[model samples]
Target: MRALIAIDWGTSSLRGARLSVTGQVLESREFARGILTVPPGQFEAVFNELFGDWMAAPHALCLISGMAGSRQGWQEAPYCPCPAGFAELGQHLLWLQADRIALVPGLSCMNPDTLNTPDVMRGEEVQLFGALQLAERNTATLVLPGTHSKWVQVEHGRVTRFSTFMTGEVYALLSQHSILGKTLDLNGTFDETAFLQGVDQSQQAGSVLNKVFAVRTLGLFERLSAAVLPSYLSGLLIGEELRHQNVPPAQGPVILIGSDALTLRYTLALRHLGIACQSRGAEATWAGLHALATKLTNKP
Candidate 1:
């Protein structure tokens, strides 16, 4: 057997790759990730039907990340605590269907009593690790832009701490589902002038959060174009990330993962804040799958 395959099954898509002993995506493609589309009882059946088309042999072993381990996915994987080193991960692992199929656990951290608010994450953890693999570094910070954005910090091959933001999800909700959907789709390229404007607004001193209501109130008063609200909202979130987030420039390197457009927005945001940033790994999901496959195979 070749030893490994990496599967990235997210909420809306399923992608996998057949790897040689060396990490490489022999084949990877996107498919429906919706539970409704695949149905509960028929998961394996649908999975087979989709990938079975090009299967040479069942992967020697497949490691999956993302919603694939959610309650709605093929299995439920546990959330390991932070300060999780490779040894702990090796010991605290979960297997969905015997030794042949396994999952890399998502992580969670919290202040037990004071804030009851815990940070929980699903798939981005694996990609962060993949970025580190490419960086070949013991420490790094990675940012992923999407519906729920993630900023993760890793030290000595362990995820020490991380934070999440609902920026993308909030943008989608207010832009499409909320009354503001009528104003803007925001599919265009990142606007430098508007993004810089948001960054400038972020440093002005008051609570940046209070400005959210402006998206609605401004629309009502004709002070802001509904069509521009999405971009402005994006700017506010990115600007806050730039201005308030305590990460420092000397904290190793920053790795960004997301579609080109979203990454572009983040790039613009970082540029506006004068933060030096670098783009890592062109294909994160694929690169992540490669890492998962390699990790599983190298384990004794």
Candidate 2:
């Protein structure tokens, strides 16, 4: 295997890795140069500027993942349908330079819960595959928490199904735009007690729509401090996200993939629910890309 230049490019940021033939990341770099920051038709030039030196390595091969392949990005790499694995992703790679540089396609599926409505993910697919490798399990439940949290199920090395929740995004909006913002101290530290209280509240039989209003009421009634209401609100949203999951004790510990900050809350919430879990971070992306690269190299 040649040295691999793996990239995880998203809407707000870009990250790159230089990996050895054996899949260990030798060096990595990150920048604020996401697709939204690049000028029209400047992705290649931007890539060359930020990572051209890495590309100079003899026999280096590059594979880019995330929004860089979206219709609004450098090139639209049509989505690879669900039940996809490394082979499917490698087969759909949108080559920028034949046999050298290419874009890793995202995944899509019809969510049965929404009446067979469609759902898709760009960069998370890479992390999902990477988590699989890190956990050494072909089938498991995985969760990626962010502005859009993802709950995924993989079976026999393929992503069979996944569902997206607007937990983070809604939290942002409610804490900023909605009346709830008036009481929340957005900069306050994580209030575990208050957060857990909200989590406990979510477990009760009631619509979140009605429960969210309690943030303001709690503040008005002086039952909770302004400094900690944010954490409480966070618990409500995250707890609600967890409430819909069906992870029985027999399925195995859930695998979490993402930054420490985001996964921390999830870890607490999951443990509170009596479900065992583990976590992996950025390395998952590198491992995922390395897995795809190895698959490509081994192809007949």
User: Whole-model Cα lDDT per candidate?
Assistant: 0.70, 0.93
| Number of residue pairs clashing in candidate 1, backbone atoms closer than 3 angstroms, sequence gap of 3 or more or interchain | 0
**Candidate 2 lDDT by residue in tens digits, 1-300:** 778999999999999999999998888999999999998899999999999999998888999999999998999999999888888888889999998999999999998878998999998999989889988999899999999999999988999899999999999999999999998788899999999999999888989999999999999999999999999999999999999999857768999998998899999999999989999999999999999998898889
Q: What TM-score, over all chains together, does every model reach?
A: 0.86, 0.98
- Provide the global lDDT of candidate 1 against the true structure: 0.70
Clashing pairs in model 1, backbone N/Cα/C closer than 3 A: none
- Model 2: how far is 63 from its true place, Å? 0.6
- Collision pairs in model 2: none
Instruction: Name the weakest run of 10 consecutive residues (lDDT summed) in model 2.
Output: 244-253
